[model samples]
Target: MNGLIGKKIGMTSVYDSTGKSVACTVIEAGPCVVTQVKTEQTDGYTALQLAYGDTKAKNTSKPLQGHFEKANTEPKHKLVEFRDFSIVEKAIGEIIKVDDVFNEGDMVHAVGVTKGKGFQGVVKRYGFAGVGGATHGQHNRQRAPGSMGASSYPSRVFKGKRLPGRTGGDNVKVKNLKVLKVFADQNLILIKGAIPGHKGAYVILEKK
Candidate 1:
């Protein structure tokens, strides 16, 4: 899972070489700095700690300021650990460009947190059919989930029942998405189809 921490820059449509129109999401990927490299001997496992997005010096805490000092880079707004590869071979402060790991037409996997929709009802969250009749003295109960349990049988609802409460804002991983294009100068990566989460949200892209 050697990948880069990136931001979704929204989506657009592009024409492929075969003259086919393709819809894609644009991501502003790294240029991320290698902050720390962990090893089994010293840290118990091999991993690379990458830092992306910049934070103003004044806005950053003193502790983080000290951490960036060792890397000889400014404080960043986001820091993530990627363990799939031995990134420790890269020196501290070493930069990983998106181009180094991916190219156009490469299959990729992306992980992101979806937008939060807050509390939701079963009809919207679980695709429940909801109340059947609109008439016959039914109004507010139209969206209700009807009976939730057997009256005197089990005496309780199942643990994993699909009753809805909170919705969205979950970590979602989308796999086998194709990379439509790569713009190195702008750090923009065009991915086929929609990605999870809203524009400007952070996402991790892995070569598949």
Candidate 2:
């Protein structure tokens, strides 16, 4: 699938043709450099290794420093490969902008890390209804995760139990978001609906 690495620029509401307020998310979508191209004959797979976001030489590692040098580009903060990626006959060091692939009314899938909610209990994390009512001497066990397993038969807590230890900070995908607008000049694309990740977080926008 063809895609681009973008940064979430937060959400805004815009009035549609019917004068209805539609919520949308703004993203700075590429101007990404094609650092490497993987071919079937050479790498046993087809992919486009694209890089975005610039960084200083002192901040980049030695291996990556050499990589950007081969691409004839500056040090970048982000690099991702699109397996079986389709695009123009782009060579190494070529830049791919948002307008090159996407347009208004296009459907896309946005993937990114969700906002971290830190440590939480079952009620907040898993939406588990705790033992309700202040009956059966239930005092402060309202938000507790009740009976995990059989005491003697199954002594240990079973794996994949929905007991909350940590919440959020997971990679999530929001699919079928309609591209409401595309700004080639500014390298920005507005999509309908909320996407995963906080502001400035990197998101992968995949064409659907």
Best by TM-score: 2
Candidate 1 per-residue C-alpha lDDT over 1-208 given as tens digits, one digit per residue, 9 for 90 to 100: 6889999989899998899998999999999999888889988988888999998999999988998989999999899888856345798889999888789889999999999999999989989887888789888887888887897989999898888799999999999999988999888899999999997999988777
Query: Evaluated with lDDT, which candidate comes out highest?
Result: 2
Show where candidate 1 strays beyond 4 Å. Answer: 57-61, 84-88
Query: Cα lDDT for residue 70, model 1?
Result: 90
Task: List RMSD in Å for every model shown.
Answer: 1.9, 1.5
* Candidate 2 error regions (>4 Å): none
Candidate 1 Cα deviation (angstroms), residue 32:
0.4
lDDT of 2 by residue, 1-208 (tens): 8999999999998889999999999999999999999998899988899999988999999999999999999999999888888783689999999998899999999999999999999999999999787898999888889999998878999899999888999999988999999999999999999999999999999999
How many Å off is the CA of 95 in candidate 2? 1.1
Worst 10 residues of 2 by lDDT: 81-90
Per-prediction TM-score to the true structure, in the order listed = 0.91, 0.93
